[model samples]
Target: MKRKILLSALLLPAVMAFGQQYGGMWIPTELNEKEMKSLGMKISAKDIFNPDKASIKDAVVQFDGGCTAEVISPKGLLLTNHHCGYDNIQSHSTVENDLLTNGFWAKDMNGELPNPGVTVDFITDIKEVTAQILPGTENLTGAELTKKINENIEAYKKAQKTESYQTISVRSMYYGNKFYAYVIETFKDIRLVGAPPSAIGKYGSDTDNWVWPRHTGDFSMFRIYADKNNKPSEYSKDNIPYTPKHFLPISIKDKKEDDFTFVFGFPGRTTEYLPAIAVEKIMTETDPAMIAVRDVALKTLDEKMRVDPATKIKYASKYARVANYWKKWIGEVEGLKKSNAVEKKKQYEQTLISKNPAIKPTIDGLNQKYNEQAPYNLHKAYYSEVVRNSETLTLAGIYSNYIKAYEEGKMDAKNNEALKARLTEVYKDYDAELDAKVTAKILALYANKTPAQFLPKDFGMLKDANKNLGTIENMSKMSVITGRGNLNGIKTSDLNKLFENPKALVANLKKDPLVEMYGSFKSSYFETTDAKVTALQTDIDALQKKFMAQQMETDKDRKFFPDANSTLRVTYGQVKGSEPRDAVSYGYQTHLAGVMEKYVPGDYEFDVPKKLISLYNSKDYGVYKDKTGDVPVNFTATNHTTGGNSGSPALDAYGNLIGLNFDRQWEGTMSDINYDPKLCRNIMVDTKYILFVIDKYADSKWLLNEMKIVK
Candidate 1:
């Protein structure tokens, strides 16, 4: 079936059987049913992701990206994004482990280790019973409101108990305006399945992070495990794999222009309902400013890390985090500029108001609040967001003062003991070598480059002190390293000794440089993070309540989808390509062979393992193909996706996930606002490539047997 014909047919019914073509799956509310069917979807919205499908709950998986996954097989098989599982991969790798360098393999079932602190959930039910819940919520307290909502849910659950779907849950939407219940069967035996080497997985790393013409294979694998009863269970060697009710079928057919598709999994957030003015600020100011802050921080960290290897390791996690947000904010800004998302939103709002009289005032009121609130948030962000992070060294000074005071008999028992305990807990996770490196990296840049304007007036700074602390110098000169170790190594009795002498403590404070800086830095830090946070919290909580209220207002005539709330939700779009940012639309065609051409061996990030590099250099292109070519190293598809979609499945028509959507091109990063097929191309690694690595490199044939693989 050709994609164009399929698209035309699918769109035909939506436009009143006329000649106009309905766009891609842009309007989730108005899905092109006929077109979707042409592409091989046999299920309705109710059927495909129905709350009734016992498997929908069972199939769901929660990813670190705030994404979701589903169980595909009975033998503990889980599926999620390469980026979603990136942390786990990085964590399991150290100097000796080097899993990121060579990749990881259990070889046999016995070798697999369970991941700690990760869990997968299945939503049992979601429904709307607006008739039963909304009338009396106006006068209730927050807790009272929650209680009423829960009470309504309990009644529904009790009424529905005599059914086959016995495992049930109730949800209240739109604050208290609506209610629903669900019956679910959750499985707990999920485990790590497979992942490619970073050479293939995070190929371009930060360089190609938000860029298109990408060659990254961002995907990972996990499996669901269950007890013999096929019910959810904690990890145990004897647990069996779960059997999914209707797993997505696979297809080799590619999605071309205008293909009908849907994205499934929880989308972390979307403020699409915001006013035009709010959208304008995000496009013009907020994102760019935030990106600038991140850029400054990243550059500062990178410079120090590059000069000193010791500092590099300490700032590794911090660098990754700043880079991640920097990439996202940059991508979003560029995408919005190219797609004119703000302009389109303005036009959309105008049209809505022009056509509907009542909705206009409703929108007007909303826009007023939106405009008033946007800039306030951004101004607050600078001081508050960076306060804790930027002042850590200063806080350390405060701790030093307390310690020295106790040892010299200048501090009381309670204050002396408290300081030691706090410092003791913190250093347990602290890496001294890394800490020094990170600290130096931050201090050097601020000292050498930044204008004094960035800091508050009293920031007498480390540069002014010249590594010399009057009294603080003497205490730090009395080094605290001898007592370094996690909780188990520190003795409570030894902590008592520091408090016995208070004069030495008072003298130590005068020598600690960090403490000298803090005497000035403390008031401002409190002014921003603590005081401002308290102020912001009041407003944010009020907004949450109003957000709840807004949901209630829309419930009468609309099925209100919650505001993500960073909760799980499954969105469905198709494997497609778009022309969101420019004249030439995007296309779906990338091959594994192109990875070699894009490769730059020994180029830091391009430093691939000997094996995968050899495979590419040796023309081990495998059998990947496209209509006009062999395969592209990377291709862009017009699938709806966002940050949390990091580890989402790019399934084919038969529903078998053919690729994993990890990112969008830099030009289309603003896809969360308005999707433009040309620029908003989704980044995915071919399933075939994932398979090739597993079969040729990892040699894990047991996993291959579990899936219905086709050549």
Candidate 2:
């Protein structure tokens, strides 16, 4: 027994050391300072995040509510992924001056283009409020407990003292075991400064998106503007560039493999603690269903885009949005299977139950609940994919809400204006002919895949002789949504006329074929599947929370980090590469030479600009060239990141910017569920490459003078 105890104690430290070396999205306040120092972090935890003074956290902001961005200069020069800023860029693009194709560089501050609805939020403070939130709900379970906690949060937010510019938001962590409130300041006026053309910014396009050894210069620049007092305000001509508390200095020093690195940003979501059964469900049923539906949509779009340049421009952003996840899901299924995540999870569960037999019931109950919820989960996935992917159906859903509001006597002038504005935006880049084709294919797939019991009452009417295309096309010709079949359906210009007569409009819309079809699908989902899924999910969540607590209690030696909930986090690791499979090794970085090797003239995905080629031939890389006499495009690191980590800052030992985090290796996409350091590596664009593009490529050297560059 003495020997066994000694051996167990020794093994505990080794296990913790392994965890420290690789996987974890840690909270900045609760950092493992000792381990970080051991891993070569020269700066202290306080230097990274200090609430009382200026620190690194002050420079990082949530870009437009979806991705992360870092301030690079005192004048509020911001850096983020090109894809994060793609929507704004596309918005400013025209057939004559297509910023997406020709790129854009603001020669002076006055030339910077304004983005109307874009905003960036800075997290000023984060404080743990678990003590206040959980005190009154000790005996409560399920909905009652949730209701009381929300009430407590509302009271806490009202009681806290904050500045007029600050807004308070509360988020649950560790599955409700802890809660943190964030004080955020949002800046309304953000403008685009510069971006590389698609040939450079999106070099590989969809083909090399999640792959390593990437040559894409996936970075863009924006600036934040504020009122005269440097406070958050809506856009106006009098506003000036806001001064930031602290900005990251760029490091152009040559880096090597095994160098220490860390990523700081807000990661959207992850399910790292789910049981084996739940992981299996995601791998087998959920991902495959979504993939199949998107496959049809992509094939149709790809064929259409190749034939018509106008269509290509209209659908470029939409295609990227769809293809991004379609490929990610494919890679995730392969990664989960390759990593044997489910089996490993089962073994871990066995150990947990072996350590404390009392928790066996909880684990078993959770697994059973997941098994019962699998079918409903699949139905939900198919429904969401079908509804969201079809533009016509999406518009139908919007009109459905308008009809409901008019019937409920809730429609006002403000709501009518908002509806008109939304419809105009939707129809701007919309193609009814293309949507009709995509809708017919996706609807057919949905009918074939989803179980008959869960389908809508008139689902059969969508299919003719087991082939949905002809029937769907016929409906499209006659329906008012697509405006394709006959001239009787509503046109884009005719929508405003319908809104003039509320009662008649509702009556006509209720009779419209597309609106009726959408209503059937939505009604069936809400009445039959969604309610059951929600009830089971509530029970499952309660059980999972209990299971999480039990695991913590049973394994006192283990260190736990909360799952990402779109909150600020810090994940540290080394700049390294991996052998994802036998006989297939990947390098740590890719150089400019790799770009030339992949270049193809007049190709949509691989075309290189003439000026860039001339510069490359002359070897005029300036100060951005690496020690090896080549410009480093991208590098791989072992940072655990996910969706919202896009455009996060990859920092060096002294907290200087070394690279910009963009994409994860394809195999590592599964890190959202199970993280393996060997298989998971986040891809980043080298800062040197960013500098080269700004100085040599775009000839925007004046903007570089605002930055603090360290050689």
Candidate 3:
């Protein structure tokens, strides 16, 4: 048949290399050991991942579901990026004792500070379950196919013999062509060990984030604790430091260009194989629109933070988290355009379709779906950005829970106790004035920019009020959520009044304009836009799965890798730099002198601690200094990485920890979709710099003695 011939042609090109080398989030179990060895990976695949044996994978962990961390000592002394641990650090900081500004060091085990609700998950097993997950469903399509797959996944998980402390979940890989089950043991009692002040940990702060030739120390320390049995347990006085199955030895040897390197960690998400239409939409519409909204938020937060030290302390983590991705979107859009990614994807699609005209219909459907859903996607983004980013709207969301509980007649002593605890936590860090300003600006933008039909009826009806959402004074007075001022001013008595008489609370909320507006938005979003978006996305996913299956079948020899989905993966490359653009060559490494060069006295982002400055000036790097007689601060490598790889270990050829992966060069953030091996480089804080800060700066020699250090 013509279809058969066309499929064969598609398979021919699919198996051939596209010429770019060594940039993939590879599965540790399925790695091509011979090919990896040829690419300068000196260690065997078994050394990287072996469920039954002690390996590097034993030390890597998912930190608080958002970042990665590695065990550096037998006592489970954990190392992660300062930014990854920023929230925990900020949680412990106050204006009077400002741990964030001045840093903290635990002189001994007893001094380690416990972080409530923080968890570290270690993978105990990963198995390919595609054979079990996809059977009895290959002939099905659309919702039925998804339903069957999910049911199979549930059955698989239910069958696993897991402990109370262990959690197992299944994730689809290669766009649902394969399923992987990961067995994870999560430790709930992760504690902070030490960190440099924000000045050292976040040198150049937002200004130098995601840039190359960097000097940010960007490292923080934590310790995982367990009960005497060395099993997962909550924080307790009797809990002791956990002894990990394996831990990485910190290396003091100098790194050079082309020296073998690799990174292992969980990466959040990637759409590397999206059709050209989706890529175009991201670059042209979605990213720019979201970026604009976040820019407004960042500006407001930054201005307020600069003026008030308490506000700065309160919003530092929030501001940094928001600004990080906002800036990244700007860079991603620019990079996608500069790389001609959309056009390249189009060309690749054309080539594949030309070879296999049988797939033309599938490709057409995918493109049409993307084009149709573009506007809705953008509207959904605007809604989330406006409502979720504004504290007023987010707080309103909480009140909706109260309203729901009232309607369901579920309010009781136990529930009220839980509600009180939630309110207390929310109010502790809540800033009324800052959030009010943000609410005004965010609401105005949403009112003007979001599609009229997508806007809540109440919000849309009031759009004629000078194109603004009215004064904060009027809005707050009408809001039960804001408590006639803001959430912090809300009292226990106020909630008690609501819980005492659910009917009275319902009547009150029904009359409250802000509460009614929140209800309208919530109902409209789920009833209309959310439902529509979900249906369209389901169609898109089905089409994508078809295309992915084809690619997998055809490209049997291409060494295809799965896209990142917050699952553990190994990426290997070398210590290298790039000329991102013409006349802008960057080197592989940076040193203490560069840190001094960037230092600015009394500056928030660039201020160096006087003691650190003195040590740098005296060249007192001690045993941590590289062969160049200068302490290395940070370096770049060609290893492909993304957001969740933050705090992942950058290992040398011999499996020693040499650096901690923290960021990527700004020009290469688009590597998540379009990896150009020459331009894409991961930034890491040199482990030696971490050692210097701990041993020399913090005078934590006792802690250094715990680590297994290598020359």
Candidate 1: regions farther than 4 A off: 1-43, 51-58, 87-96, 129-133, 139-185, 253-258, 305-317, 355-364, 367-375, 388-562, 566-587, 617-634
All candidates: TM-score: 0.73, 0.91, 0.87
> What lDDT would candidate 1 get against the real structure?
0.55
Q: Which regions of candidate 3 are displaced past 4 Å?
A: 1-22, 32-35, 87-99, 113-118, 157-167, 186-191, 225-243, 300-318, 413-441, 451-473, 476-480, 483-506
Scored against the true structure, residue 567 in model 3 reaches a CA lDDT of 94
Give the least accurate 10-residue stretch of model 2, judged by summed lDDT: 1-10
Residue 371, candidate 2: C-alpha displacement in angstroms: 1.3
- Write candidate 1's Cα lDDT for 1-711 as tens digits: 011111211222211211112223222222455655665565564544555554333455555336666555545566666667777777778898787766776765666657766666555555556666555666775567767766766666677654342366555433334455544554445566677777777787776677655667666777666678766677788987666665544344444543444555656665544556666777776676566555655775677788987666656555665687678777788777776777776786576555554556555655665555554555445443333333245345555556556557676657656776776655544444333434443444334333353444534354443352342334333334323222234332365554355455455545445455545454544544355445544444444455445434543543334434344454444444444433344345555554655667665455566776666567554554445434444555556567676666665544566666677777676766665654566777666666667666677878766666544
Best by TM-score: 2
Model 2 regions lying over 4 Å from their true place: 1-21, 90-97, 113-117, 226-240, 303-314, 424-437, 458-466, 485-490, 497-505
lDDT of 3 by residue, 509-556 (tens): 677666676777778777667877888999999899888877666554
What is the Cα root-mean-square deviation between model 3 and the actual structure? 7.9
RMSD (CA, angstroms), candidate 2: 6.8
Worst 10 residues of 1 by lDDT: 1-10
Tens-digit per-residue lDDT, 594-633, candidate 2: 8888888987888999988988999999888887798898
TM-score, ranked from best to worst:
2, 3, 1
